[model samples]
Target: MNGKTSVVKHRFDIKLARSMFGAISFGMALTTSAFAFDPLLTHGAIPMSPAAPLFANTGSGVCVFDSMPTPLTLNEAIERALCNNPKTREAWAQVKIRAAEVGIGRAAYLPTVSAQWRGVRDETTTNVTNYPQYSSNYRNSVLRTESVTLNWVLYDFGGRAAALQNANSLLEAAQASQEAALDDAFGAVSKDFYSAQGARGAVDAQKEIVAAAQQTFDAAKARADKGVAPISDQLQAQTTLAQAQLDETKAEGELATAIGTLNGDMGMEPNTALAMPPVDAGVKPDAMFQETVDALIETAKASYPSIRAAQSQLDAAQAKVRQTRAEGLPKLQFVAEYSHNNQPTTLAVGIPQFPATGHEWYLGLQVTIPIFEGFVRNYQIREAHAQADYQHEVLREAQIKVASDVWSAYQTLQTATASLVSNEALIEISRKSYEVSGHRYEKGVGNILELLSGLQAYARARVSWIRAVNEWRSARLQLAAKIGRIPSR
Candidate 1:
C-alpha cells in the first residue's frame, strides 16, 4: 500500500509540471504576436483593418462649353489688362527679376562650393657634374600631371552683407512700382470706358433731336403747301433740320473717336467690335465735398503705388549706404579642400624613376582687412550717401504731388456736382418756356421769329444739360479712381 501511494504522488507532480509548461508557452506566443504587429498596433492593440484614404477617387472626365467669348466686365478687363498688357507684363517681369535678386543676395550668407581640374606635360634636359670630373648630359623625360582644386571667397569686409541689404530693398521697391503701374492702368481704363459711354449717350440724344426737327420741318412744309402757313416758315424749319443733321454727324464722329480712345487704352485693335455700356442716368452724386476729399486723401495714403515705390527706393538707398560702410570693416571665413593627383613618367639615361601618385588635404581660415584702395572706397561711400539723399527728396516730391492731385480732383468733383444740379434746373425751365412759346406761335399770338428763338434756346438748354450730365459722370469716375474703388463692370 505504501508503494502504490508513492507512485500516485509522483504522477500528480508530473501532471502539475506539464500544465505550467503549457501556460508559459501560450504567454510567449501572445507576446511574440504583439511585437510582430507593433507598427499597426495602437494603445497596445492591433486593428483588424486598414484606415480609409483622405481623398475620394474622382472619375475621369472633362467639361466643355460652347459660346461666343463672354462680354468682359470691368473686373475682367482689369484682370485681362494685368495679364495681357505688354507694359504691365513687362513691369511684372521686372518685379520677378528683382525678387530673384533678393534671393541671390540672401544666398551670400551661405557657403558656396566649386571644382576645377588642370593638366600639364613637360620635358627637360639637365647637365650634372662631380667635384673633379667631366660633366654628363641627362636625357629629358616626359612628365604628365593632373590635379583638382576648390576655392571660396569666404569674406569681403562686409561688402556682401551691404549688397544683400540693398538688393532686398530694391526688390521691395520693384513690387511697389508694379502696384503703382496697376493702379494707373486701372484709372486709365475706367476713365476711357466711362467717357465712351457718355459719348454714345450724347450721340443717341442728338439723334432724337434730329428726328424731332425733321418731323417739325415736314409739318411746316405741309402747312405751306395747303396755304395755311408762309413759305418762310417752311424755309426756317428746313434750316433747323439741316443744322440738326449736321449736329448728328458731329456726334457720330465724336462717338467714333471716343471708341478709338477706349480701344487704345485697352491695348486692343482700333477696329475691334466693342459694345459700349448704357449710361446709368439714374445715378445721383450725393457725397459731400468734405467727405469726398477725406476719402480721397485716405485712398492716396494707402493705395498710391508711386508713393510707396518712392519710399521703397529710399529704403534701398539707405541699405546701400549701410552696406558700403560695412565694406570698410574686417571679415572672417572658413574653408577646406581635398585633392589627388596622378602622374606617369619614364626613366631617362642614368636617371632614377620617381613615384607618380600624390594626395593632399587642407583646412584654413581667411581674414580680410580693408586698407586704402586709392580712395575708391571713399568715393563709393560718398556716392551711396548722395543717392540716399536723392531718394529722400524723391519721396518728398512724390508725397507733395499726390496731395496736389487729390485736392484738385476733389475740387473738380464738387464743381461738377453743383453744375449738374444747376443745369438740370435750367433744362426744366427752358422746356416749359419753349412749350409756351410754341403754343403762342401756333395760335398766331407770337411771331415765327419768337418761335424760332425759343426753339434755339431750348436746343441750347438741352445741350447744356447733356454736357453737365457727362461732366458729372466723368467727375464721379475720377473720384472713384482716386479712391481706388472703380465700380466693377
Candidate 2:
C-alpha cells in the first residue's frame, strides 16, 4: 500500500508540473505578440490609429446608404453630410498621419539592430633569403565573417520625451480641427436644406401670382370683346400674362438650383433629386439668443473648436521648442555586438601554414555631445522659438475672431427675430389688399392698372415673407454654431 501511494503521488506531481508549464508557454506567446513590430507606411502595416479613441474615421462613404428620407429633416441632412463629406474624411486622414508621427517619436526610444557580412580571397607570395640561397613560397586564402550589432538609446536628457509630447499635442490639435470641420458641415447642411424649402415656397407663391395675372388678363380681354375697353388694354393685359409666365419659369429654375445646391452640400451628385419639406412657417425666438453680446462672445471664446485647436497648436509649438533645445544636449546609448571570422589556411615560402577562426563579443556605452555643427543647432533652436511665437499670435487672433463671430451672429439673430413680426403683418395686409382688388375687378368697379399693381405688391410680399423666414432660420443656425450647439436637432 505504501509503494502504491508513492507512485500515485508522483503521477499527481507530474500532472501539476505539465499544467504550469503549459500556462507559462501561453503567457510567453502573448508577451511576444505584444512586442511584434510592423511598418507604419505600408498597407501591410498594423493599424495604429485605433490607439486614439477620440479621432476615428466616422464616415460611411458614398456607396452604401439607403435612400434619403423623403421630406428629409434638417437633422438628417446634417447627419448625411457628416457621413459623406470629403472635407470631413480629409480631416480624419490628417489625424491618422499625426498618429503615425507619434509612433515615429516613440521609435526613438527603442533599439536599432543591423547585420553585416564580409568575404575575401587573397593570394600571397613571400621570399626568404639565406647567406647563399633564396626560396619562395606562395599561398591562397579565403576569409569570411558575419556580425550583428545593436544600438539602444538609454537616455537623451528629455529630447525623446519632448518629441513624443509634441507629436501627441499635434494629434490633439488635429482632433480639434476635426470637430471644427464637423461644425461647419452641420451649419452648411442646415442653411442649404432650409434654403431649398424657401425656394419651394417662392415657387408656390409665383404659381399663385401667375393665376392672378391670368385672371386680370381674362377680364381685360372680355371687356375688349364686349367693346367696353380699348384694344390697347387687351394688348397690355397680354403683355402682363407673358411677364407672369416668365416669372414663373424663373422661380421654377431657382427651385431646381436650390435642390442641386442642397444635394451638393449633402455630398451627393449635383443632380440628385431631393425633397425638401417645409418647416412650420412661424418664427419663434430661441431663448439661447437672449444673452448679451459680451456674454455670447465670452461663451464662444471658451467653446469654439477653432480656438481650442489653436491652443493645441500653441502647445505643440512649445513642445517643439523644448525638443529643439534638447537637441543641443548630450546623448547616451548602449551598444552590443557579436563578430565571427573564419579563414581556412595561410602559407608562404619557407614558412609554416596557419589556420585561424576568431569570435568576439562586446558591450559598451556611447556618449554624443554636440560640440559644434556650423551653428546649425543654434539656428534650429531659434527657428523653433520663432514658430512658437507665431503660434502664440495665431492663438490670440483666433480668440479675437471667435469673439467677433459670436457678436455678429447674435446681432443677426436679433434683427431676424424682430423682422419676423413686421413680415407677418406685411403678408396679412398685402393679402387683404389683393383680395379686395380682385373682387372689385370681378364686379367691374376696379381699374385694371390698380388691380395689377395690387397683384404685384401682394406677390412681392409673399416672396419677401419667404426671404424673412430664410434669414431667421439661417441666423439661428449661425448663432448655434458660434455657441457650439450647431448639431442640435
Candidate 3:
C-alpha cells in the first residue's frame, strides 16, 4: 500500500510541472503580442500641446464713457469708417477672395504631384479531386503598394493662357469695385460732414435773428406800457416773440438731426456725442469754367472707378471668348510616374519565401482632341462673344452717363454761384432797411407794422442767404465728386 501511494504522488508531480510550464508559455505569448501592437513604440505617436493665444491684449477690461468727447476731423472719421465699418470690411474681404481666385487660375500652368497607398489582405482555399474531399489551408497575406505620379500640362491650345488672363482681369475688376466703394463711402461722409456744419451755421444765424426780434419786441412792449404805443403794438410784439421761439426750436431740431446722421456715418452709436473739427469754408470758385471742365474730364477718365471697372469687365470677357474657342482644340500634357513593389509568397507547406522586388519609371506625352460634343463647345464660344459685346455696350453707357453728370453739375454750380452773389446783395439791403425802420419806430416816426415788415424782410433775406450758401457748397461738392477728386478730409 505504501509503494502504491508513492507512485500516485510521482504522477501528480509530473502533471503539475506540465501545467506550470503551460502557464508560463501562455504569459510569454501574451507579452509578445502586447509588444507587437504597442503604438507608442511601433507607430511613434506624438503628443501635442495646446495652441497659444492669438491676441496679447483683448481690450475686454477697458471701460469707456459715453460723454467722452472726441474731436474728430473729416480725415479721422474716414479712417475710422475704413477700420470699423462692416460694409467696408466685407468689401475688403471680397477683394482678397478675388485675388486668391486669380492665383488658383494661374496654378493650372504648374505640374501636380500626388501619392497613392494601398493595402490588401486575401485568403484562399482549394479542393483536391484525387482525395474526393475538401482540404482547407489557412494563409495570411498582406500587400502594401505606394506610387508617386506627376502630371503637367504641356499645352492646352491657349486655353490655360486665356483663363489666366481672364482671372487677372477679373482681379482688376474686383480692385476697381473696392475703389468705387471707398469713393462712395468717402463721398457720403463728406456730404454728411458739410451738411452738419451747414446746419450748425444755420442754427447760429437763427439765434441771431431771434435775439434781434426779442430786442424789437421788448422796445414795443415798453412803449405800449408807457401809453405811447397802442395795445395792438403789444400784441404784435408777443406774436413776434412766439415766431422767434418757433424758429429757434426748428433750428435746434435740424442741429440734432445733423449730429445723428454724422455720428451714424462715423460708425458710432447714434446718441454718441461728437465734436467736429473746424473746416476752412473760404474755398473760392476761382478756376475758369472751361478749365474746370477739362480738368474734371481728365480726372474722371483716369480715376473714375466705374469706368475702370467697365474696362476690366471688357478685358475679362474678351479673354473668356479666347478661352472658350481654345476648348475646341486638342490638349497636350506630360505625365510621369515611379513605383516600387514587393511580393511575399509561401512556396510549400511550412516554407515562406519573398519574390524579387521591382522598380518602374516612365514618362509619356498625352494628347486629348475634342472630336465632337454635340455642339456644346460651339455654343460656349458664341455665348462668350455675346458677353463681350454686352461688356462693350456697358462701357459706352458708362461714358455717356459720366458726361451727362459732369454737364449737370456744371450747370448747377453756375446757377448756385449766381444765386449766392444776388442773395448777398439782398441781405445787405435788408439789414439797412431793418436798422432804419427800427430807429424810426422807437422815435414814434414809423408805425409798428412797418417796423415789423422790415424785420420780416431782414429775416427772410438772412435765411435765403444761408440757404444759398448751403446750395453753393453742395454744388461744389457734387462737381468735385464728378471729377473724381477726393473730398476734403
Q: For all candidates, what are the clash counts?
A: 1, 1, 0
- Candidate 1 error regions (>4 Å): 1-73, 76-79, 119-161, 281-283, 288-295, 345-355, 435-447, 483-489
1-489 in candidate 2: lDDT tens per residue?
Answer: 111111111111123466568778987997887446444432222123321122234432322457778787776677677666787767768776787788888788889998776655544434333311223343434456889999998988899999988988888788778778777776787788778888888888888888888888988899889988777767877887888889889988998998898888777888988777764643455575777888778888887888988998999999999998888899999999999987545353334557778899999999999887899988988999999999999999999888888888888888988887688899899889988987886777877777777888888888888888888988898888777765245
**Per-residue alpha-carbon lDDT of candidate 1 for residues 1-489, written as tens digits (9 for 90 to 100):** 111111111111123456468767977997899545433212221111110000013122111112213333444444444444566666666665676666667667777665544333333333333321222232223322334444456777677877877776786676667666666666666666666777777777777778767766776788789888899988998998899889889988888988787777656677766666555443566653356576678778676777888988998899888888887777777777766666534464335445576767788887877787888888999999999999999998988878777788778878888898998898788778878877786665866567667667777777777667767766776666555555433
Pairs that collide, model 2: 137-349
Clashes of 3: 0
Candidate 3: minimum summed lDDT over ten consecutive residues — where? 47-56
Cα lDDT for residue 240, model 2? Answer: 78
What is the C-alpha lDDT profile of model 3 across 1-489, one tens digit per residue? 111111111111123456568777987997999645542231221111000010113243212224434555555655455444565556556565666667667678889998765545434444344432333343445555669999999898899889988987887776676666666666666667667766776777788888888998899999999999998998997798789779888977987898898878767887877765433353544543446666677668776877888899999999999999998899999999998766555564324344556678899998999898999998999999999999999988877777777778878888989998998999999999999999999889999888888888988888787777767766776776666664442
Can you tell me which runs of candidate 3 are displaced by over 4 Å? 1-72, 82-87, 119-142, 277-284, 288-303, 341-358, 487-489
TM-score attained by model 1: 0.75
Query: What would the TM-score be for candidate 3 when compared with the true structure?
Result: 0.77
- C-alpha positional error of residue 234 in candidate 2 after TM-score superposition, expressed in Å: 4.6
Cα error, residue 159 of model 1, in Å, equals 4.6
RMSD of each: 22.5, 13.7, 14.7
